[model samples]
Target: MSEAVLRLSGLEKSYNRGKPNEVRVLRGVELALVPGEIVALVAPSGAGKSTLLHMAGLLDVPDAGTVEIGGREMGGLGDRARTAVRRREVGFVYQFHHLLPEFTALENITLPQLADGATERAAQARARELLSRVGLEARADHRPAALSGGEQQRVAFCRALANGPRILLADEPTGNLDPATADRLFDVLMELVADEGLSALIATHNLELAARMSRVLRLDGGALHPQA
Candidate 1:
């Protein structure tokens, strides 16, 4: 069996601690993602799905428990170390494409690789390859403003994978697309994930999409539970 690429154990988080308006988010949540597995995170709004993802992706820390990637614990790491580990081990995709309007699709993808120490030529080559995989090779030179919503998201996907991360954490990646566009982009996303043998934890409200993943974990009542 594939080893766990992500492990979240006994995690706890809250806002406005010790205040009347405080809201407790995660409550001792635990989750594990094995290599090459794609897991869906299903949760209603205000259930802290994004909060959990933020902790997992190292963008934020929980009040208690641990976040580990590839067997390395992340709780006490300093900012620079955490940033380095996150950059090397995790890729994040949000609901919005968030591509830079000034850069071409290929450049948007290439920039991440370059930031991660890849040579310019290598970055460009990888960008082209990823764009081709998503059927965006012909749109490589077009900026985000010139592309359709689906196309922009495809570029975002390419950018996420540019650094060869071991795990992907996506927050409603296809939420803004129309049903047909969402379906098509989802197929492309899964294909890319499978081809790379990477583990993914994706948040989505679409039950149909959730059902297609390797497994689904629903976040409710401040905890994670297997859905069927």
Candidate 2:
């Protein structure tokens, strides 16, 4: 069996603390993703799917519990250390493509690699390779505005992969696309995940998409429940 790449234990997060409108987003939520395993995170609207991904991705700290990646505990890590872990080990994809409008698709993917200290030549090579994998090579020089919604998201996927993260955390990655486009893009995503042997936790409302994953976990009322 593959080693666990991501693990969350007894995670808890709350907002508006000490106030009447306070919201408890995640309570004791636990999950683990093995290397090369693709797991689905299913939850309804406002159910803290984003919160869970953020916590798992190390973008935000949990009020309680632990977030671990590659067996390294995240709690108590300094900001620079946590950021280093995030940049080196995790990749994030959101509902929105969130590509830089002014940059070409190739540039968007190359930028992360550059930030990670790759040489300009090496970064561009990796960017071109990933863009080709997503069938976006032809659109490499186009800006986000010039691409279709599906193409933009495909570029986002390439950008996420440029850093070669071991784990991918996606929050409703295809939520903005039409049914046909979402399905196609998801297939590409699954292929990339399998090819790279990266573990992934993707949140989605679509049951069909959820079923395609290796395991499905539903988040409701701040807890995670496995589904048949």
**lDDT of model 1 at position 215:** 96
Model number with the top lDDT:
1
TM-score, candidate number 2: 0.98
| Model 1 Cα lDDT, one tens digit per residue, 1-228 | 766899999999999999999899999999889999999999998899999999999999999999989988998899999988888889999999999999999999999888889999999999999999999999999999999999999999989998999999999999999999999999999999999889999999999999999999999989999997
Choose the strongest candidate by TM-score: 1
Candidate 1 deviant stretches above 4 angstroms? none
Provide the lDDT at 202 for model 2: 97
TM per model?
0.98, 0.98
**Weakest 10 consecutive residues, lDDT, candidate 2?**
1-10
lDDT of 1 at 110: 93
What shift in Å separates residue 25 of candidate 2 from its native position after superposition? 1.1
Total clashing pairs in model 1: 0
TM-score result, candidate 1:
0.98
Provide the clashing-pair count of each candidate structure.
0, 0
lDDT of 2 by residue, 85-196 (tens): 8988999988999999999999999999888899999999999999999999999999999999999999999899889999999989999999999999999999999988
